[model samples]
Target chain A: MVTDKHYAALDQVLELAVLINDDMTRSLAQDGLTVSRTHLLWELRRRGPSTQRDLADALKVSARTVTGLVDGLEATGFVTRQPHPTDRRATLVTFTERGVRTVEEMERGQQEFARLLFAEMPEERLDCFSEALGEILIRLREASRLTDPRGGDQ
Target chain B: MVTDKHYAALDQVLELAVLINDDMTRSLAQDGLTVSRTHLLWELRRRGPSTQRDLADALKVSARTVTGLVDGLEATGFVTRQPHPTDRRATLVTFTERGVRTVEEMERGQQEFARLLFAEMPEERLDCFSEALGEILIRLREASRLTDPRGGDQ
Candidate 1:
C-alpha cells in the first residue's frame, strides 16, 4: 500500500523535475537556444566528435530525433556532420568553434545557477539530499530497464 | 568547496530527472497523449473546470501554449471551451466525458508504474529517499523564487 507520505513525496519529485527543466529551458531560450539542441551541442563539446548513433544512445533519444536535431544544429553552424573515419555507414558529429563557445557560456550560467540553489540549503541537508537523490536515481534507472526494454536496444 | 560526492549526487539528480520525465512522456504517448496535454485534462477533470489562463498557471505553461493545447484537445472532442459566465473576455474549459475517462486511464497506468518503481527499495530507504527529495525540492523552489522573480509566472 502506498502511504500518504510516499504519495506526497512522489508528487513533489514530479513537480520539482518539471520546474527545474522549465527554468533551465527558459534560461537557454533567453540566449536563443532550446534545451534539446543545447544538450546535443554539450554532448559533442564534452565528448569530442561522435557518431550519430552514439550521440542518440547517449542522449536516450531516437536516432531520427537526433538526426532532426543535428540538422538544425548544422543549419545554424553550431555542429557539423561528416563521414565517420572508419565506419562508412555512420556519420560523425562535432561542435564548431562557435558551438564550443556557446556551450562554455551556458555551462558558466548553469554553474552560477546551481551555486545559488545549493547556497540556500544547509550544508548537511544538501549532502544528505544529494545522497538520497542518487540512490533513488539508481533504483529508478533499474526499474526503467526492467519495464522498458527499448532503452536497452540503444 | 564541492566534494566528489556532491558532484556525483548532482549529476544523478539531473540524469534521473531527465530519465523519469522521458519515461513518463513515452508512457503517455503510448496512450495517444502528451504529458503536458494530459496534465491539463487531469486538472480539468479533477477541479471540475477552469479557464485557459488558470489551466496554464496550474500546469506552469504559457497561456498561448495552453491555447494551442486546448485547441488540439477541442479538435479531438476531448474538451470544450465556453465563455466564462461572468467574464466576457475569458473562457472556461471543461473536459468532456471522454477526456475524463482517458485521464483516469492514464492516472491508473502512472500509479502502477510508480508502484513498480518503489517496490524494490526497503521501507526505511524509501522513507529517507523521499524525505531528502522533498527537502531538496523545497529548497530549489525557494531559491528559484529568489533568483528569478518570474520563475513560476505563466
Candidate 2:
C-alpha cells in the first residue's frame, strides 16, 4: 500500500528536518544567533537596509516580534537602528560590517550545503524530487489549513 | 540550474515541516495533549504497559523528561502508574481507557492523512520520490554530521 511508503517517506522527512534543525542550532550557537535571527539577517542582506515595519511585513511576523529580534541583534552587535533618511518617523535596521560578512558566509555555506546534497543526484531524479516536493507541499498546506482552528478566517 | 531546483525543494521541505507541525499542534491542543504526551500514549498503546525507564529509552529522552510527561499525562487522566508486576522498584505507565481511544484515533488520523497525501500519486513517481528521499536523507545526515561540532563522538 502507498500508506506504508508514505509513512516511510514521512519518517525520512521528519528525521531529515530534525537533522537539519539540530545542525543549524549547533552551528548558530557558536555565533549566538538563532534561526529567527539568521532569517532576519538573511532578509536584510537580500533587501538592503529595511525599516522594522518592513521587516515585520516581509517576515510575516508582528511589529513587536520584529522589534524584539532587532533589539536582540542590535545588542549582539550584528545590526543597528539608524534614523531613516527620508522619513523622520521611520527607522532603518542596517547590518554592521560584521553582520554583512556573517550573512555572506552563511549564504555561501548554505549554497555549498545544498550543492553537496543534490550535486551527485542525476538531474532527472532531482527534477522528479522537486516535483514531488511541490505536490506534497500543496497538499500539506491544504491539510494544515483544514486542520487549523481559525480555518475560515485564513 | 540545479542549485535553484535544489533550493526550491529545500524551501518546500521546510515549509511542509512547518505546516505539518502547526497542524499537529492545533489538533493536539483540542484534546489538551501536546505532541510528547500523544507520543507516550501511542507508545503505550503499541507496547502495552511499559515502565517509565523503558519509555525513556524507547523515546530517546531522559528519565526526568519521561517522568514529567507521565506526570502531566497522569494529571490529565490519559495515563496512570501501576507498580510493576515483578519489579518492586519499577512502575508501569499504562494508558487509561480515554488514552487508548485518543491514541487509536490519532493513529487512524495519521494513516488517513498519509493516504490523502500520497494516494493520488502514480506508483512510478512515488517510487522515484521515495528513492530520491532516501538519497537526500543520507546526504542530509552526512551534512549534519560534518557540520556538527561534536562530530567525532558520534
Best by DockQ: 2
TM-score of 2: 0.85
Residue-level lDDT of model 1, residues A28-141, one tens digit each, is 774446889888888887789999898898887899999999998888888898898888999999888888888889777766656655645566666766765666677777
Model 2: how far is B144 from its true place, Å?
3.9
Pairs in steric clash, model 2: none
Q: Please report how far candidate 2 places residue A17 from its true position, in Å.
A: 3.1
Which candidate leads in TM-score? 2
For model 1, state the Cα shift of residue A22 in Å: 1.4
* Candidate of highest lDDT: 2
Kindly list the per-residue Cα lDDT of model 2 for residues A73-121, writing each as its tens digit.
9999999999999999999999999898888888787777678778888
Show model 1 residue runs off by greater than 4 Å: A62-64, A74-77, A81-91, A117-131, A147-149, B60-64, B75-77, B82-91, B119-127, B146-154
Location of the lowest summed lDDT over 10 successive residues in candidate 2 chain B: B145-154
Query: Where does candidate 2 stray beyond 4 Å?
Result: A85-90, A146-154, B86-89, B145-154
